[model samples]
Target: MYIDPSKKPYPFCPGCSHSMVLDAIGRALEKIKADPRRTVLVSDIGCVGLSDKYFNVHTFHGLHGRSFTYSCGIKLANPDLLVFNLVGDGGCGIGGNHLINAARRNIGIKVLCFNNLNFGMTGGQHSVTTPFGGKTATTPSGSPEKPFDLAGLVSAAGGSFVARVKALDKEALDETIAKAFQHEGFAFVDIWEICTAYYMPANDYKKQQMDELIASYGFKTGILREEKGREYSRVLNSAVRFQTSDVRRQTSTTLTATKFSHTLQKDSIGIIVAGSAGMKVIFAAHTFGKAALSCGLHVSQKDDYPVTVQSGHSVSDIKISREKINYLGIDKPDAVLIISQDGLKEVTDILPKLDNGAVVVYDKNLQIPKTEAKLIPIDLHGLDKTVHATAMLAKYLTLNKFMPIEALRSAITAISKDKIRELNLKAFEFGTND
Candidate 1:
């Protein structure tokens, strides 16, 4: 069975219309004979999201309103797999842009939107799809906004298939969903439902009045639009074939060979280089990582900085090891390089946690926090601030004899161009001489 029987007693409010929709989905999948291993059920946050556990197929529970985006990625990555997204009216409103774009792209993904006329999961607030004059927790006097006709919107947005069906209509719900599953391109089904816990009590709703309410809102039931078109993935693959081959050829021509002449004393080492923005901190760390790679070592580098692009502290955490590195985070770094006041402030807490044998390299003008690690003060004030990171890293490597100076020079040559290359090489020479 597509739905796991072991997960019996699905979580839903008594008399909730969502339960009916879930059952319809399972029945439709069975009718299509879809393979559970190749089928993916992507769900957004809300009362409907709780249905993921009941499905035995591959499932992804993601952030609210993002189920369509995730489903699109999965479908594009492997067009052979069947991808389905379960979203609520609240999700439809929040992710309205994604909804229209998904339809416009004509990607092969089926969307089943549970429309209960309100934000049922979050205290029954008025949602983008809430009917005009509908009573909700946030709209006690009735909502002023006109509800969205999801089927019509998707149809206009270029969806290959679109339909609207009542959740309680057993035969129609099952038939509509099955047809959507069989469609080759983007398909959407708007399932009209009721929120028993919030929307029902507020509106004094009855199951018998569902048809009348749909008519009063000017919504039509059954298939609204259907057409044949080329799927998005196939079109993209055909368009990019030549460009992809050109990129591969251009990449292969730039590669160079080098020999290793240095050995690391430890199995692994974690290093942090901290500096201000525009100091090329990340670039220096990447160059250092390449030098380590030339010495036949594995390397990983992660960079951090404030959202304000050019006016904050910047740091690079680098891992170099003889063995393959899995995790990138470093709790206690073996070496820390601080080159600016901003960099000093960023690493204050980290300095106190360093072990006794660890090294803390910083500019001579800066006051450092107390730490058990050995401190090495350097005269970096005379050099260009942008080159301070490379200079400090060079000094550390030269002192430990962990890597040959020639390897760093080659890396700087390979990574930098024009006047910047000359400056970086001079900085490396200064660090070694000092």
Candidate 2:
């Protein structure tokens, strides 16, 4: 049984069409004899999201409206798995872009959108698919917005298969869902349903009313569109080929033979490189991570910056260890490199809490917060502000005895282009000499 015996008595409200839809999905999966282990049920926040636990198959419940995006990633990463997204009309509206793009790409994912016409779980608020002139909690008199013809929209967006079926028609729902599961490319089924708790009481809606409403909107029922096309992952795989030997030869040619003789004082070392967005702080941290990797140490690096491009503070957290690094987060950094006032402000709260004996390297011009860690100041009067992160990193590595300076030089050479490489190397030299 696809449904877990332990999770019997599904959580949907009595007379809720979601329960019927869930049963239809289970029956469809059984009819196709789909492998539960290879099947994934993706859902977002709503009445639909509550259905995952009742199914024994692999499941993912994410933020409202992001189910399609997650399902796309799963399908692209491993195309053999059968992926299905059970989302509500609210989710459809919130993630409309993802839905359209998924259809355009024609990825092999079955989307069963529960079109109940309202945000049933949150309130009886009208949704994107709510029929025009339909009364809802938010639309007391009637909805001003026109409902989306999901089948038509998906068909126009290049979906290989599209269907619209009433949730109460058990036989048709089962057959349509099974067909969607069998489709080779993107398949979308707009499952018309009624919210027993909210939508029904508000509009006195029922199965008969649903049919009339759909007809009035000029929306077609049954299989609306079906056409064969190359599936997205298959096409992508066929177009790209990896030349491993050439890649290995290129990597070997660029990397220098630099050895590390010093050992880490702790089991793992955390380092933070903070600067303004355009200052290459992330790049410098990545280069440092590569340098540590070349010394046979496990490394992980994470970067943070504002959505506004090249205009705000940028920070990167790096972890290096003799053992494999499991978690990338750095609760307390062993070394901190601050290159600008923006960066100083970003890490001000963290400085005072640093562990004793930790090292901090900062621009000599910036006033630093109180900290118990060892402090080293470097003057950046002659170098470009963009390379300040590189210089500061070099100085920290030199003083902290984390890795040999030659490793940093090798990384700079391997990662940077002609002029950038020259500038970075010069910055490295300045840091080491200063």
lDDT tens digits by residue: candidate 1, 321-359: 888999998877999999989899899999989988899
TM-score of model 2 (CA atoms)? 0.76
**Clash tally, candidates in order:** 0, 0
For model 1, name the residue pairs that clash. Answer: none
Best by TM-score: 1
Error of 2 at 218 (Å): 3.4
Off by over 4 Å in 2: 4-16, 44-50, 117-126, 133-145, 194-210, 233-262, 270-288, 300-319, 327-356, 359-398, 409-434
